[model samples]
Target: MVLNELGARINTALQALSREAVIDERAVDALLREICGALLESDVNVRLVHTLRQNVKKRVDLDELAASSNKRKVVQSAVFDELCRLVDPGVQPWKPQRGKQNVVMFVGLQGSGKTTSCTKLAAYYKRKGLKVGLVCADTFRAGAFDQLKQNASRAHIPYYGSYTEPDPVRIAVDGVAQFRASKFDLIIVDTSGRHKQEAELFAEMEQIAAAIKPHNTIFVMDGTIGQAADAQARAFKQSADIGSIIITKMDGHAKGGGAISAVAATGSPIEFIGTGEHIHDLDAFSARSFVSKMLGLGDIGGLVETVKDMQLEKNEDMMKNLAKGVFTLKDMRDQLQSILKMGPLSKIMGMVPGMSPEMMQGFDADESTRRLRSYMCVFDSMTEAELNSDGKPFENESRLRRVARGSGVRPVEIQALLHQHRQFGQLVKKMGGPKGMLGKMNPAMMQQMAKNPAAAANPANMLKQMGGMGGMQKMIQQMGGMSGVQNMMKQMMGGGGGGGGMQEMMAQMMGGGGGGMQNMMAQMMGGRR
Candidate 1:
C-alpha cells in the first residue's frame, strides 16, 4: 500500500457509513472530517486537504437524495470521484510517436531517484518492442554516467555517455545525434540532479533542453517528500517544459498521496509511477483506476490489460475450457505458468480489485513463486489420468501419497494444492458452466468482451447487473459468493496473478469478446453514446 494508513482510515470511515441504518448530513460531515484528518496526517498540503473535504461535501448532498436511492452508493461514488479529481490535473500525458525519433529528458533534484527512473523508463519502452537508447548527460554528479551505463547494460539497452566529456551539453548533443543516426526510436537523456534547487542547475537544465530539444521532459519526484513535492515540481516546471512526471520510491512512502496529488496540481499528468526498484516496477498512472484500487473497487481494466499483453492469445484450449467453465488441474497449471510469465505477484496483485498492494505485502512474491514451482513439481509427479481426474485423485489417499513421494514435497502441501485446485474448478464451473453467469451476457457485449480479459470482468458491468447493493448481495448468496470469491482470489494468488475472483470472472467474461469493456458496458446499460 502506498498510503496504507490513509487507505485504512478511509475504508473504516466508509464501512461505518455502510453499517448505519440511515446516512444523514451528520454522517457525511463526520466521514469527511475523518478523511480530511487522514489526508493531513499523510502529509498532504493543508490547502489541498481542505479542498478535498469541501469538494466531497459539495458532491454528497443529504437533502437531494430520494428516499428510494441508495445513499451509500451515492456517497461512495462521490468519494471515489472526488479522490480521482484530487489527483487528476486535466492534462494528457505525452505519448511516444512511432516512425519518429522521440527524445525524452529527465530532470529533478538530487536524491529524487531521477537517474534510476530514466533507465526504468527506457527499459519499459524497450520491453514494449521499441528500439530504445539512453544518453547520460549528467556531468555534475559523481559516477552519474557509470550508474546509467551499468543500468543500461543490465537492461541491454544501447547507451551513449563519456567519462571524459567535461561538458554535459556536448555529450547530450553527440549522444542524441549518434542514436538518431542509428535510427533509435526513443532516446532518453539523463541530466544532473542537484542536492537542492539552484540557479546554476536550472541554467544547466535549460542549456541541455536547448541542445537536444526533447519531445518530453519528465520531472522525477521522490514520493517520500510529502508536501515538498509541490515546490520541487513547480521549480522544475519553471526551468523546463515538464511534459510528464514519474513519482519514484512509492513502495516506501506513507505520504505518497501528498506527492502524487501535489505533482498533478502542477498541470502535468503523471505518466508512470515507480512502485518498486525493479526495472518493470513502473506503472502508467490512471486516476480512475488508481482511485478505484485505493477504495477496494479494484483496477479490473489494468488486470485485463496485463493479461492481454501477456500474449496468451494462443492459449486456445485454456480459453475454450474457461468458456465452458471447466478448470482442471492442467488448466490451473497453465494459468500459473501464464502468471509466472507476466511478472512478480506483488505487482500483478496491485492491479486487481479488492486486493491492495498493502494487503498483498503479507504474501511474499518470491515465496509464492517458489510455491507455484512446488505445485508444478507435484503436478509433474502425477500421472496424466491423475491430473485430468477432475478431483477424483485427491479423494483417493493412495494417489495423494504417491504424488507426495514422487514430488519429494510434503503430503500436506500436495493436499493443500489439491484442495485449492478443486475449489478453483468448482468456482469456475459456477461462473461458466451451463447457465453460467457469463453465459447470460448480451450477445453484443459478449462479442466485444471476447477480445479483452479485463473488459470481460469489468466491475462496472458487474455493478450494473447486480442492480447495485441489494442485487449484489443476493447474487453473492446464490454464487456461494464471498467464499467462492475468496477461493478464486487464493487460486489467482497461488497462480501468481494476484487477481482472485475478479480475474477469474473477467477471464470468464471474455466470452471471447474483442472490443473494449466500456463499449460492452454501454450496450448492457443502454447508456451507449
Candidate 2:
C-alpha cells in the first residue's frame, strides 16, 4: 500500500474510538497497533515505526488524563503531530531570492527522474514570473539533450545544450555562464544519472558543482525505491553537498512513506513532490500540510494558494450573486469553469476537509471537464432568459426535449443538471446565503479556519451563526441525524457506501440534481452504463 492507504488505515483506527463510551488503555493500544502495522506495511523504517509507537504510548496515558480533557482528541492530536515530525528533517528548504541568478543543479541515480524534475522546477519558477532557463549537461545518457530540449520547449523555458558536447563539465560551466549573463533568475542544470552510485558519477558531479557553483544542489529520489533511498540519498549528499531533495513518481503505486522518511533521515528537507508527469504537477512540500491531507484533514494552505493564483477577483460578479443565494444554471457553469482553472478536481477535493485521495479517485478530471463542457452546451441551447433565470426554466418537458436535441444529450441529463443547480441554491440558502461561511471568509482566514477541527468537521458550528443550535438540530434531523451525517461522510471519504440512504444523501450533498458525483462522472465519461 502507498502512504495514502496507510493514512486511511490509521484514520479508521482513530475514528473507531469515537464509538467508545470512554477511551481506555486497551483502546489506545489497539489504535497504536493498527497505526504501527500500517506504517510498517508502507515500508517505513522499522526502528522509526517502533519509536513512533513508543512515543504515542507514552503520550496517551488514559489514567494520567484529566477528567475534563477529551481522551480521543488528545490521542489523535499526538498521532497527527508525530506523523508530521516523522517525515520532516527539521531543515529549512533552499529558497531562491528574487531578481538574483540562482543556479540549481540536479543529481540522482538513473531512472530517478532527475532530468524531468529539472524542467518541472524550471516551469514552476517560470510560472511564478521568474526568468528561468534549463541546461542539459547529461552527456552520459544517449538523447539526454533531446529529451531536455523537448521538455524545455513545452515549458517555454530557455535552454542551452549541445549534441556534440562530449564533456558534461564544459556544458555545465558554459550553460551557467550564458544564462547568468542573460540575467535568468532561475537557471537549472541537469546532470547525468548512473545505474548505481559509482565513483565516475561522483567525480563528474564534483567537477560540475565546482564549475557552476550552483546556489542549491537538489537530489531527486525515486519514491518507489522505499528505504533504499536513504543510502542513495546519503551517497549523493556526500558527493556534491545536496542542499535539498525532490521525490518523484509519487503518482505511482509506490509506498512513498519509506522514500520520504528515508530522505528526511539523511538530513535533507524535501523541497517539492512530483505528483505526476505533467509539467504543472510539481507541488511545494510541506510536512504538516502533507500529513494533514493524508489523515483526511485537508490542506487549506495549498487550496488557498491555488485560489489566489486564480485571482478570484476576476469572478467578482459571480461571487456577489452566490452570496445572495442566487445560483442559476449560468452561475453553476461559471463555477465549474473556475474549478477547471484551479486544476484537477481530485486535487481540489483532496484539499477539502474529510475528503481523501481515495474518495477523490472517483472523480476523473478529464471526464469532469467534458461533463462541465456538455453542461455548457446544454445551457447554450437554452434561451438567454432561461440561462439567466433564477427559477427552474427546464420544468417544461418541451423545453427539456428541445435542449436535449440541440446539445446531443439525453433529457434525463438536462434534468439532472437543473436539479443540481437548485440543490446548490438550497445549500447556499441553508448556510445563510450571502454573508454565510464561504462568502464571509478572506483567503487567509479561510486557511486558518480549515485548520480548526471544530470549524472544518462540525456542520453545526458552521451553521450556528446562521440559525443557532435549534436550526442546526433541525437540519441534522432533516439529514437523518448524526448517524446519517457520518454515513454520508464515509461515502464522501471513499469508504464505499452502498446503502440507499447513504447514496441519497451523497446525491444531495453533491448538488448533482438527483445523481451523485459518481453518476456525474459516468455521464461525463459517456461509457458503458
Candidate 3:
C-alpha cells in the first residue's frame, strides 16, 4: 500500500501465477505475459521489462529451477531475483575510512524533496553516532537557507550557510572548512534545484563540487517524474560523478517503478528511498525486499525485525507471551506500539507480501492508528471475566453492550474487536503449538525467528533473515547488551565478511582470550551444537 497503484498491479500479476510448480510450458508463458503486462502498466521501462521476461524464459529453459513438483516456487524465486537485479544490481557500500570526511552532495529539481532527504540522511547518520554537518548551498532559492537550517536544527547537526554569501561555491568551501574545524565525521552539501538545461546553473554545480570535492554525488529524483527519470539521471551524470540515486515522494507516486528502472538502466545504484514527508520516512534501499514486496510474496522478516527493534524494551516479554500462545488485546496494543515505532502501518504493511500500492492508496497512517487505538479502548472496557474467558463474552449480548457504552464506541465496533481478538488468539495458539511452524523450529532457528519475525512470515524468504549467533550478537550490540559474542565472532570471521565479517574483530576489541577465539572458530566450523 505504500506505493498503492504499482503494488496492486504487481500483486495481480503475481497472483496469476502459482508458486508451487508448473509442468505446462503454456502456463509459464502465460505467467510471463501477465508479468510483462503488469510491469508495463506500472510504467516500468519497456526495455527492462523485455529483458526481465527474456531472463525468466531463459532460466525456465535451463532447468536450473526446482524439481517438477516445485517448479512454480523455483520460477518465482528466479523472477524475484531477476527483478531485484534490474532495480539494484548490488549493494553500494559507503566507505568512510576510504575517503576523508565523506562529503555527499544532493541534486534535484525543485519540489523533489532534496532538502528533506538531506535532513533524513543527517538524522540517520546521527542515530549511528556519527558526527554530521549540513551545508545549505542552495542560494538561488530565496528561503533555502532558512528551510535547510530549520531541518538541521531539528536534527541537531551543525549547519553552514550565509544569506549574504551569494556565491554557492564559496559557501560550500566554507561549510566544509567549518565542519572540519568542528571534527565532524560526515558533511552533506545541499544544492539548489536547477533545471538541467540551465547551463549557468549546471556550471555552478560543477564549481561547487570541485571546490568541496565531495566523496559522493547523489541525484535525488521525484518518483512522480516517472519516465523522465532517465533523462534527469543522464543530465546529472554528465556534470558530476553521481555515486548514488535517491527517489523521493515514493509513497504518493504511482510511477515509482519508472524512476527505479530508469536509474538502474543508467548504471547508478539506488542508495535510499523516501516513503513520506517525515524525516524518519527514509529507508535504505534493499533490492531483495523491494522485489519480493512487488511480487506480493509477503516480507514478514523485515516487519518482524522492525517490530522487534522498535520495541527493544518489550521484545523479551513479547517473545515470552508468544511462546506461551497468549495474545490478548493488551498484546495487540503492545504490537501496535511496536508498529508505530517502525513508522506508518500502511508503509510497514507495504513491505508485506501481496500488498500493492493500490491497496495502500486510501490507507492513511493516522487513521489506521486512530482505529487501532479505538479498538484497544473498546477491549479495555470489557470485564476481566469477559477477557479471560473468551467464549462467555461472545455468548452474551449484554456484556458487549456494556463494553460499547463504556468505550464510547458503537456496539458493532466492539463486536468486531472481539471477533478479531478471537482470530488472533487462534493464530497465536497455532504458532506456539507443535503443529505450528515456529514451534517445530530448534532453539537456534527460534532465535532467528524471534529476531526477524517479519522475514519468517514472508511467503518467499527472499530477504536474508538476520538471525543465528551473528544476528544475536548484532542485536545485543544494538540493544546495548553484552558484546562478548560479537567480539568472538569478529575474531573468528576475520572481518572479511566485509561489514558482516567483523564479529571476530569485535572479540579482539573486547579483550577476549585466545581460547575464547578458538571456541568461536569452532562454532564457525560448525563444531558447536
By lDDT, the best candidate is 1
Q: What is the C-alpha lDDT of each candidate?
A: 0.72, 0.69, 0.64
Ranking by lDDT: 1, 2, 3
TM-score, cand. 3 vs. native:
0.66
On residues 339-428, what C-alpha lDDT tens digit does candidate 1 reach at each position? 665566667666555665445655667777677677778889888877666767678888788888998888877766666666667756
Residues 1-529, candidate 2, lDDT per residue (tens digit)? 1257877788899878777787888888888888888887777888888988888888887788899998889998889878887878789999999968898999888998899999989987776788999999999989899999999998788999998879999999999999988988988999999644478878988999998898899988888887787667667766778788898888644388677765555688889988877786777888988887677776666755655454433444444453355666666665555555555555656655555555566555566556656766887798878878864667788888998999997887777666556655676565434355444535543443334422332333334332444544555565566656545555534322211122222323332221112222222211111
Error of 2 at 83 (Å): 1.1
Relative to the true structure, candidate 3 has a C-alpha RMSD (angstroms) of 13.0
Error of 1 at 283 (Å): 1.3
For candidate 1, the TM-score is 0.79
Off by over 4 Å in 3: 19-25, 62-69, 95-100, 155-157, 308-338, 354-364, 371-529
TM values, all candidates:
0.79, 0.76, 0.66
Error of 2 at 269 (Å): 1.3
**Ten-residue stretch with the least lDDT total in model 3:** 508-517
lDDT of 1 at 17: 85
Q: What's the distance in Å from true for residue 34, model 3?
A: 2.9
